[model samples]
Target: MAGPNAPWHQKKNHPVRRHFPFVLLFALLGLSALASAPAAALEFELGAGPVDEIDGDGTWIATASWLTGQRHPWELAVGMIGARTQAQGVDTGDVYFVSVSRRLTWKRWFVQGGIAFTDSDNEVLSNHWQFRTGLGYDFGRFSLSVAHLSNANTGGRNRGETFALLQVAF
Candidate 1:
């Protein structure tokens, strides 16, 4: 019978697995549109890096942020664009995370922290909530930084995801 037990069915197949790419595209487009608006001092950044595991093996990570620009040395941003990982023959599935963060800047250097709400509880993100933090240096339209995400021991496997990201600001 062509049912759940069929050869074409896989145990790891999430109901939404086939729609991930489309989801990613719409996210990117939405962020880009926000950045394209004529609002003054609006800022947008796109970043990618590696997702590290305790075993020293890692996965690729991508992220993006949209903020209200620099004002009074502090700003608020919506940081999102989820990530996925495959470890030990286990697919962590898609991670849908969104956070409202406070970005503080001093001269060309900046530090940010925020609380994130996530949709997946997997190897990398084992909780319904996560904390996001980053430190970086801005160079005109570009920046370099490291981003760290953790569950603060609220769930299983507190192993955090930390990576170096090169950001393009527009």
Candidate 2:
């Protein structure tokens, strides 16, 4: 049992939520940089995968990214993460995130690394700050990739989340 004064009881006062505006500002700025330019292609991805935890079923994710018109490596994306649940159990809170990632490709095989900021906090993803990395193959109008999201022990008790994704280009 925990006392009323404990940190867990104080959601509104959490450091990340207290500083949310600053985080959102930066994320928006990064995305703006990508959207400002005329995108060569826009990509949308949908995915689901198992959560790295006990009794975890799976998690779902969707994202939108603008691929730079030329072969530029930088991309900005905004996405939503669905909550995970145990077998016939309750669901955790959903997370909304924005990320700025750079993709390096070699003959349709590509890898991406980026930093992400999330707006919600919950058991599955305890921290508001996260790091994202993934690798996959681009099959012309679509792509197959797997992305991992980690809070990096920023809030402790981190198990990280990984998802296998399918992407469509428009």
* TM-scores of all candidate predictions against the true structure: 0.66, 0.75
Best by TM-score: 2
What residue runs in model 2 are displaced by over 4 Å at the alpha carbon? 1-17, 39-54, 87-91
Query: What does candidate 2's lDDT look like per residue over 113-134, in tens digits?
Result: 9888876666666677888899
CA-lDDT, candidates in order: 0.62, 0.71
Point out where model 1 deviates above 4 Å: 1-38, 72-86
* Model 2 TM-score relative to the real fold: 0.75
Residue 104 miss distance in model 2 (angstroms): 1.1
